[model samples]
Target: MAGLFRRTMDYLYLACVVVGTTALVLISAVIPYAVFTRYVLNSAASWPEPLAILLTIVLTFIGAAAAYRLNLHMNVAYFANKLPPAGRRLLDLLVQLLMAVIALFMIIWGERLVEVTWHNTIADFPFLSVGITYLPIPIGGFCLLLFIIERIFLGLPPDPITHGSEAPSFD
Candidate 1:
């Protein structure tokens, strides 16, 4: 059962990474197109602005989720390495819990925002709805939330690479 759970989580994490990568590529392509159309052709690409905005939001969250699963958040661990094992574990748990709380809040607030945007439409891209723009927030929030929960179960260190760290390597 534990193996199954880990595999599932890994699969989800991989999916988020693939999606995020695709979004990044799309953003790069669209932004250049938008710029080229506006300057060279004297007209903006109507879809690029909204698409880029939405893609960026998605990429941010997805990247965050990937980072969380891999325990790749930015932090200095050189000092934490001097601490005793218990102290390190305590600090690790605290950091993980704090991140979990933040993800929870994002999920809650993002859902509300999604609901509000669902009914409306975007100004520049009339064919596309606002819900599409808002979708990334909740989706990323939920993915981050899942990774956070899994991290809690995995008992991750605040900084796994801290000085003299002997913890098993992962991710």
Candidate 2:
């Protein structure tokens, strides 16, 4: 069961990385086309900018969840590092609990946001529902929540890239 859970999480992390990277690549492609069409071709393409904006939403949320799993998310530990071992452990758990709260908030509010915009169509891409574009929010939040659970229950999974060989944190 434990192995299965870990394997599932590993796959989820991989998916997040792949999807986020693809979104970023698409955004890169989209923005250049937007620029070229507007400045060089003498006509701005409306779809490119909106498409890039949508892709950016995917990149930000999914990429952040992946980063959090790998402990690559921004973390300031100045005060945490100063605590005694026991105090540090407590603080670490506190941080995790707080992260869980944040994840829940994202899920709840993100869903409401999606529902509220469900019927709205993007101006440039009328066939695409605005709510469909907002899916990454709740999806990313769920991924984050899963990763947090894994960290709390199983300890951090071995970093896929580093295999847990990161430089030791302060004792």
Candidate 3:
């Protein structure tokens, strides 16, 4: 059961990566078109800028959750690395607890933010609610919380180095 759950989470992590990557790819495409339209065509495209902002929101929140799962985010672990094995383990736990607090903060506040702004819509995309744009914050928070649960029960995922030759995994 645990293995199954872990494997399922692997898929969840993949989803985060996919969403983030897609947003990045889209932003790349949209920005250049905006530049081309403004310079070459002598007409500015209003939609690109706002669309890019929305994509940025997706990339930031979703990519962060994925990065958290892999321990790939910026880590100034210099002090932690010097600790003995037992001390290091304790510190890791403390770090995870702190991360949990951050996750809960995001979930609660993000949801409230979404609710408060639900009626509002983006100017560029009038049909899209502002609340929908804010969904990524809470969704990413939930994903991170689940990853924390996995770590608490199953320990940290394997180092990317060992699995680089095989599937994508944390690698």
Candidate 1 has its poorest 10 consecutive residues by lDDT at 155-164
lDDT of each: 0.80, 0.91, 0.92
lDDT of 1 by residue, 1-171 (tens): 756767777888889889889999999999999999999999877878878988898889877787777777687998778999999888878887897888888888888988888878878878777877777777777888777777778644244345555666687
Full-model lDDT, candidate 2: 0.91
lDDT of 3 by residue, 1-171 (tens): 899978988999999999999999999999999999999999999999999999999999989999999889998999999999999999999999999999999899999999999999988899999999999999999999999988888987766555545756553
Q: Give stretches of model 2 more than 4 Å off.
A: 163-171
Instruction: Evaluate model 1: give its TM-score.
Output: 0.84
For model 3, state the Cα shift of residue 121 in Å: 1.0
Model 3 weakest lDDT span, ten residues long: 162-171
Give the backbone clash total of model 1.
0
lDDT score, candidate 1: 0.80
Ranking by lDDT: 3, 2, 1
Q: Cα deviation in Å at residue 43, candidate 2?
A: 1.1
TM-score of each: 0.84, 0.92, 0.92
